[model samples]
Target: MNDINLEKLRVNRGAHAAPKKRRSSNTRTWIIAGATLAIIVYALLPKPTAIQATQVVSAWPSQQYQVLNATGYVVAQRKAAVAPKGTGRVEWIGVSEGDVVKEGVVLARLESRDVAASYQAASANRQVAEAAVTSAENEMQDADRNLDRTTLLFNKRLLSVLNLQDAKSRKARVAASLKSSQASLAAARANEQLAKTNLDSTQMVAPFDGTVLSRSANVGDIVTPLASAADAKGAVLLIADLNSLEVDADVSESSLAQIKMGQPCEIVLDAYPDRRYRAEVRIIAPTVNRASATVTAKVRFLDRDPDVLPDMSARVAFLSQAVNADQQKPVMAVSPTAIVEGEGGSHVFQIGADGRAHAVAVQVGAVLGGVRAVSGNLKVGDALVLAPGSKMSDGDRIKLADAP
Candidate 1:
């Protein structure tokens, strides 16, 4: 009876285990099929393209009147490369780079010991010649007295003819000696002046009131009038009158007619684009560069700041008239990249709040710095796609790559 019960239990366990294995296999197959279906649906769905967007802003009214544009550099009309008068080792420097200097202020000094000594010797020689002149004059006075006495005696027959003749000859000789001494004194004075001038040359001074741009030669460096040798230094320092700063721009000859003396201008430095400098045309070259067909123009700054430096790259916007404070008022503008040429006209892809693009027609105007003025159905706060690429269409959704 016990054996029969054991066999029945084993049969019941086998029956339940077979069905569970089949059920688990079916469940795994269904899970894999569901995953594959979900992937197909995701692959066919529409996706948004990534894009960059920017907001519209106002532009200066004066920018609209810009007739022409040119690029050039800031130049100091009174700049100079201050060099020594002669070759000498630099002993001292009184000014450094960026130091403000006044005209006649000493900027540096060469090893002037030798020149100073020569000047002292020349001064002493001049004094010696002066003393000799005094001595010669005294001797001539004594000779004149003797001659007068001898003449009186001769008239009284107390002196012989030969003695009177001797006295007169002596007086003439003394006068000759005095003249020679005076000539020596004059020559000595001239020598002294020459020595003094040479000594002064060793002490380099500012040629004009300006700011020092660089110190080409330092202490112990051998500086010369010119860098004739490879080892020799040329200029002791480079300086420029900051107040005399101007923009030397190269304007195309075709646009030369747009510029004239005293014409209003807006200057923008490449280094500092945010700062706009008011300027006017100071000179327009009478000739044009044949090779480039560009005319050089000098523009003077109406107001300047310390940041304005020589050699800074700059751009000049020639205006039709002077810009008033109110003319600086902003206008609706967008980046030039936002504009796209179509058969209809120039248009921009303006992004609406609904995440869709709307093609809007615009009248493009003068391009200022990085943006161009555009009159259209747009507001200052409107968002527009930057560099709208192909496949972008009206009502197409976009995923902004960046925040405005």
Candidate 2:
């Protein structure tokens, strides 16, 4: 009986130890299953895509019709460096930079005291010559009468032949003196004209209607026809006809075929990027630059702007058609790649503040340069994704591949 009880107790102890081992094995299995589930859940979550972005910009409607684009500068076709014809010291200036002048307007005056004095002296000489000529005419009249009387006396035989011969000789001498005095009067008149011309040269006048760009000479500065001397200025005023302002743009020789003399163009000055000017091709240079392989195209403005200036950096867009008055204003534009077409129509994935892309519905309009004009809940400088993939959806997180 004692051996039987000990055997039963040993069997009970083994059964209890087996239950503890099974419990520990079950605990480890549960822990491994929980870890597997966590891993699968992590794998199913959404991942961010690396992408590039562009900003919405204010663009012109004319850009849609752009065939070619080129950079250049505003040039005045009627530009001139106005200088005096005769060299002299500058005495007075009547205009400054930015002054508008008309044709033949006197801009400055040189030292003319010496020239004026010469003119005055020549005038006095001319008057004296006139007086002398009058006296000579009276003397000639008297000589003619005396010769007639001498002839009559010789014919009547009332006077000796020697007396008549001496009277004739005196008349001939007086006639010769009259001729000499007449010649002197002509010479005096010529001298007066030359002196008057010299006096007129002392004043500088405008060549055409233009705006003064600069005043190169000041009071007491020497001005010369050619600025070869270090102390002499070549031009008193740098003037340009603002009406003749044009853009000299360089176009590639290969693209020159598209350019036409009457073709319309849009001009945007670097100084005023927001402003657009209406222009047209005025001239196409017949020659091409061998070094740059480019040809110059001259563009003229259709309407003049007071702010447009010479040599201001500019960009030219050669267009297929002219922009109307209403289309001249700016419009919202975006890259074509950023637009996504769907059953719901066109939309763009603009990156929201939360780093996720939000679809903004857009009504796509004209194609501008490399971008498309769109009207929607968009503004200038809003970030949009470029080339969104098929898997991309609304509210999907995105990682920027580049800084916006």
Candidate 3:
């Protein structure tokens, strides 16, 4: 088969054919050109410039500032339920809801009339016992004298032995009776003291200087013991020291690390939108609430106002940095869009006085609202790159959007 093919077949070369590997070489050249064109197109695409970016200088009252935000309710720092210490029917309300009273001032009274009457009865009984005790003392003295006489008679044998023995027995009986009367008097006095204690407990008094939040009881209303029958008897009055106020905030567990005792905070109440209260973090609960993935934080106001009422909705911001009155200074700020990512870190492109774009590295801190506080390489009045697209580069020419 090889001999026949060699005799009859001869290969033909056409114009389309070229020198050895010419097709491969041409294909490689086209590939290179296409790649070059792609790069050129990419480079030519229109992009934003420094003029497009809105920039501001770095200046802030304090460089380090933290605004940790959470929401909570205002609570009374010192709250108490004004309930009767001893249970009884309420007789009179000396104070009503919204009434402000001093500590130890009676807000209400129970039906202590029965207790008073019982005390009086106990007093009468005590008086009778005292009288009996006096009689007993007289008898005791008589008994002692009789015993002495009996001893003398027995010693001298002036009286019969049976008569002396009878005299001694009579004296002993009178001494026992005197002792009994003394015990009765003491028991009556003890009963009177206990009754007085119960009667005194029947008076419900304000535990501290506070305003009554509620008046749970009125004349003739029955109140029971808080421990034994609290379910059946709710608190008679909710009193709280309004001056002692606190913020009970719930912070997410992830942000709990930022919280600590004495951390400065800014609290805004929904009830008062225009006002802000200065506060400090007083407690950061160590235990996390597993179910809610939150932690309870308590804050105390450095300055309190009476208008800040309990249960007011409040927003809390725990600050890692604080800005005191003396430390407050104005910093040039711009829209957040002005900042951009650069080689080593964050940078900003600004339009210089000559109206040229320049990339400068900037130290960035907390991002708030739509502005970022920046430091280094920028100053007030410098034109910042609002949002320079990919086409922007250092040393690039720029013009403000509305420039002539």
Candidate 4:
């Protein structure tokens, strides 16, 4: 029972136990307390619904109140299928498709060898007629001199009356010959003009200033005035005045009452869908088509484009009123995705001031420019939930992902 014996007894009695087990117990208690506190905090905090949002914006004034829409084509009011005045083989073509030409510009030429030769001959004959006219005038002058001399001789009794009469007859015959020569000269000049005209007819010229749409004849193709032959080209070139382009649309007879001449219109071409061309009603047909029960109307473009060509498909939006730069007004418009279907009938989940969403009943009007025109208790800058989730409810908190 000495000191050594006491130490051995203390070791066996657990007086030197490891400190790790004690530390582990305290850690377990702390962990449990921390977990309970985190749970309580999460339960008391608000749950924000993550969502996509957009602001209601204004629509274009022209689109804000569209009366009607009709599909049509971009057409040139001043279009022509140009051909030669006379039938002949095409000798040369000066213009290709898409060439801009001025009025009376030579576009093509037909075979004119015969016509040119005839013209040359007529010109030579005209020169000969001029020479004859000059010679005839000289002879007439001589005849006047002879007649004067004969009259003087007859008065002086130096010549017999018969001889004086014979001189007078000679002068008269020369005068008649001069008169006949002048008539021949006049006829020759007329023939020259006619031949020149025929030669000019062999060349085709533009009727007006326009862009060439197509070239129908090759250098060797035969072009005819009447296009009677199967192998002959009916037109040398198809051209149109680009400045005189318009949209020809067919409107249902029932909708004619809603339109009139000089009405403002917005034209959208298929080639330039993003851009809008300002237009106005130019013509309305007096009668309706019995087959389609539609009336044809022409809409003239106020603006022009190089890309716009004849036969290009277009859409015409007949507006309620004219839309000018100063006349455009802001409108309450929302994206199509913002609309929600519910038992309340066409409602929107508008973001509230408190970061919550509240149901707002909207009376939707026209869908314009991919945005819907709506009348509701909404402002221009108000944000609305786009494609709301099923779990979303009235007064539910939401966190906007981004500004639209």
For TM-score, the strongest prediction is 2
- Candidate 4's residue-wise lDDT over 1-404, tens digit each? 53565555554535446576798999999999999999999999887888998888877647865888998988899999998778899999999998899999899888899999999999999999999889988988988888899899989999899988888898888888888888988999999999999999998899999999998889999888788998987888999999999998999998999999999998888887667778999999898999999999999999777878888999999988877864344468899888876766787899888989998889887777679888889988898999886667889988877633
User: What C-alpha lDDT values do all the predictions have?
Assistant: 0.90, 0.91, 0.78, 0.87
* lDDT tens readout by residue for model 3, 4-28: 6674575666644766579799889
Indicate which candidate wins on lDDT: 2
- Backbone clash count, each prediction separately: 2, 0, 9, 0
TM-scores of the models, in the given order? 0.72, 0.79, 0.61, 0.71
The residue pairs that clash in candidate 3, if any, are 52-386, 53-384, 53-385, 53-386, 54-385, 54-386, 55-384, 59-331, 61-329
Please write out the lDDT profile of model 2 over residues 1-404, one tens digit for every residue. 43566655564566579889999999999999999999999889877788899899988888778999998999999988878778899999999999999999999999999999999999999999999989988988988888789889888998889988888888888888888888999999999999999998898889899999999889999988988888889888899999999999999999998889999999999998898999999999999999999999999999889899999999999999999987899999999999999998999999998999998999999887878899999899999999997778999989898644
Top-down TM-score ranking: 2, 1, 4, 3
- Compared with the true structure, the alpha-carbon lDDT of candidate 2 equals 0.91
**Candidate 1 lDDT by residue in tens digits, 1-404:** 43565655565577689899999999999999999999999888777667898889877767767889999999999999998898999999998889999999999999999999999999999999999999999999999999999999999999999999999999999999999999999999999999999999999999999999998888999988868977889998999999999999999988887789999998989998766788999999888899999999999999979999999999999998898766665678899999998878898999888877899999998786678989999999899999997667888878788634
Q: What is the C-alpha RMSD of each candidate to the true structure, in Å?
A: 6.8, 9.4, 17.9, 7.9
Any runs in candidate 2 off by more than 4 Å, and if so which?
1-44, 139-179, 401-404
Query: Candidate 1: minimum summed lDDT over ten consecutive residues — where?
Result: 1-10
Model 1: which residue pairs collide? 58-331, 59-331
Ranked by lDDT, top first: 2, 1, 4, 3
Per-residue lDDT, model 1, residue 298, is: 98
